[model samples]
Target: MLNLETLSMDQYSFVANAFSFGLAVMASTTIFLWLMRSSVAPAYRMAVTITGLVTAIAAYHYLQIMLSWEHAVSIETGEVVATGEPFNRAYRYVDWLLTVPLLLIELILVMKLSQQETINKSLKLGGAAALMIVLGYPGEVAETIGTRMIFWILSMIPFLYIVYQLVIGLKESVDKQPENVKGLMHIAAYLVVASWAFYPLVYLLPLAGVTGGSAIVAVETGYTIADIVAKAVFGLFIFTIAVRKSEAEAGASGTSASKKA
Candidate 1:
C-alpha cells in the first residue's frame, strides 16, 4: 500500500497549499458574483448563487485537509496530538457531489442561451446529476483507498457528458457566427475537458504503482492549477458572455419598441 507518510514535508505542503489556494479562488469568485447579483441577468444570477454555494463547500473540504496536515505535523514531533476525527472519509466524494449538480445547472443555462429548446432538459440534467451523486456513495464508503478507482470510473460518465455538451456548444456557436458566444464556449470547452482529463490518469497510475508519492503530489499540483484556470478564468469568460447577451437583448428590445411606436 502506498503510504502518505512516506512523502516529504515539502511534498505534502505543496499539494495542500496549492489545493487550498485553488479552492479559495473558486470561493472568492462565487462570493463576488453573489455580491453583484443586481447587475447580472436573472438566470446567470441564480447560476452564480449556486456556484458560490458549491465553491464554498469545496473550500471547506480543502480547509479541513489543510488543518489535518497541520495536526499530523505536530503529532510527528511529539507535540500534543489533535485527537478529533478528521473530515469524514466521505467528504471528498461529497465535494464532487455538490460540484456536479451546479455544473449541470450551468450547462443547462448555457444551452438555453444557445437556443436549444428541450421540454425536459432540466429533468434530464437533474437526473444525471443525481445519478452521479448516488454513484459516488459507494466509493465514499469503501473500506480501502484502492476502491477509489471504482469511484473515478463512475464519476467519469457525467464528467464526459459535461465535456460533450461544452464541445457541442462551442461548435454550434462557431457555426452560428456569434463571436462572443463562440469565445466563451471555446474557453468553457477547453477548461472542462482539461480539468477533468487528469482525474483518471492521476488516480489509476498511482494505484498501479507506475508513479510514487512524489509523482502523486505533482499530479495533484497540476490538477489544482487546472482547476484554478477553469474556475477563475473560464468562469469570468462565462460571466462576460452573460453580461453581453443581456446588453444585446436590452438594445434589441429598445429598438423594436421604438420602431413599433
Candidate 2:
C-alpha cells in the first residue's frame, strides 16, 4: 500500500532521520507518561493519553516519511537521479490533519472545561484545524508558485481563526485555571503560536525564489525543527500542565475535605 523503493539518501536524509528519531522519542515518552502516571486527576489523565496518541500517530507517519525521503533520490555512477514517485510529500499534511486537532483537544481537556464549552470549543477549533490542513495540501501539490500561494493564503484563513480562538477566545477560560497552572496554560498557548507560526514561513520559501538544494534543505530542516517544537516540546508542556493542575486540584480537595471534618 506504500512505497518501498530504496535509493540513496539525499542532503535532507540526516534531517529526516533526526525528525524520525524525534517522533519516536515523542511517542515513547508520552505513552510512558500516560501509562505510568495513572493517579493524576481523571481529566488530566485523559489529556495525557490523548497527547500520547497524537505523538504515536505522528511517529508512525514520520517513519514512513523518512523512508520515503530515502527513496526519493538515488546516486547512480556519480549521478543523482530523482525517483520519489512515492515520496509522499503529503505525509506531513496527513500527520497534521490528524494531530493538530488532537493537540488542541488535549489542551482543552487539560483545562477541565464544562461539557458544553468543551464540545463547542473542540468542534470549532478542531474543525478549523482540520480545514487548515486540508486546504494546505492543494497548495503543497501545486505545480506553480502562484497557484501554491493562492492555496496557501486560503489555508491561512482557518489558521488565523484557530489562532484567534487560542489567544483571545480562550483568554478568560485560561485565566480561570488554577493559579499554579495558569501561566503554564499561557505558555502552552504561546508555544503553539510560536511553533505553528514557523510553518508558513518555511512553506513560503520556495515561492520567495529559494530554489535548488538550498530550498530543499530549508523546507525539510525548517519543518523538522518546527515539528519537534510543536509536537514533541509542546507535548511536554501539556504534560507538565496536566500534572501540575492535577496536583493542585488534589490538594484543594484534601483541604476542602479537612475543612468539612
Candidate 3:
C-alpha cells in the first residue's frame, strides 16, 4: 500500500538535512561544553560530563541515521534503491537505550541527592527508562498495526511510571533545591514530558492508515526534532542548573569559612 516512489526528493532531502543539522549541533555542543570543564565546580563536573556524553552519543547516531537514510533512498528521485542494506532506524533506539538512563542519572546527580536516595531513585527510574525503550522497539519494527499497538501500550506503562516518579517521587528532592535553580529543574522535568510526548503521536500516525513515504518522512523528521529538544536543549538546562547549584554551594562555603575565621 505504501509506494516509495510517491516520496519526493524534497522529503528525502528534508530528513537528510535534519539529520545533518542534528549531528552538527549535538557534536558541536559536546565539544563546546566539554571544554568548559574549568568553569563549573568540581561538584558538578560529572553532570556536565554526562550532558556532553548524551549529545556525543546522539551525534554519533545521527551520523549513522543520516547515512542510513541516504542509502535507503536514492537522493535523486526518492525511491528505495537496492543498497543491499536496511535503513538503520535502530540507530535511534540504540541511542535512546544508552542515553535515556544517563539523562535520568544526570538529573539525579545534579540534584545532589543523598547516596542512598540517589542509588534508589536511579535504579527505579533508570530501570523504567531502559524497559520503556526495549518495549518500544518491538512495536517500532512491527509489521502489523495491531502488533505495534500492543507493544506501544506495554511501553506506555513504564512511560507513565516515569512521569509519576518525576512529578511525585522526586518532589521532595526538588523542593530541597536552591531557589535559583528550582524553576529550571521543573522546566527540565516538563521538557522531558513535552518532547517525549511527540514520539507516540508520530508513532500513532501509521495506525491511522498513514503509511508510506509520507509516514516515513513524518516519523523520521518528527523524531529528529524531538531528539534535538530532548537531548541537546535538555542538556543545556541541566548545565545551567548544575552551574547555579555549584555556585550557590561555593558561596555558602565561603561564607561559612569566613565565619570560622
How does each model score on lDDT?
0.60, 0.80, 0.85
Candidate 2 minimal-lDDT segment of 10 residues: 1-10
Rate residue 248 of model 3 by lDDT. Answer: 76
Return the lDDT, model 1, position 99.
68
The CA-based lDDT of model 2 is what? 0.80
Q: Which pairs of residues collide in model 3?
A: none
Better of 1 and 3 by TM-score: 3
- Cα lDDT tens digits, model 2, 225-252, are 7777887788888888887776666667
lDDT tens digits by residue: candidate 1, 1-261:
334564566676677688678768877877776776555556466655665565666667667656655554433563333344442335455666666566556544643443343325555655666676676577645656667668867967975665666576336533453455666666665776776576556655545655555775776677567656645665666566666655555566876435434
- lDDT for residue 241 in candidate 2, whole number 0-100: 87
How well does model 1 score by local distance difference test? 0.60
Error of 1 at 46 (Å): 1.6
* lDDT per residue as tens, model 3, 127-168: 999999999999989988899999999999999999988888
For residue 251, model 1's alpha carbon misses the true position, in angstroms, by: 2.2
Q: What TM-score would each prediction reach against the true structure?
A: 0.75, 0.89, 0.93
Error of 1 at 232 (Å): 3.2
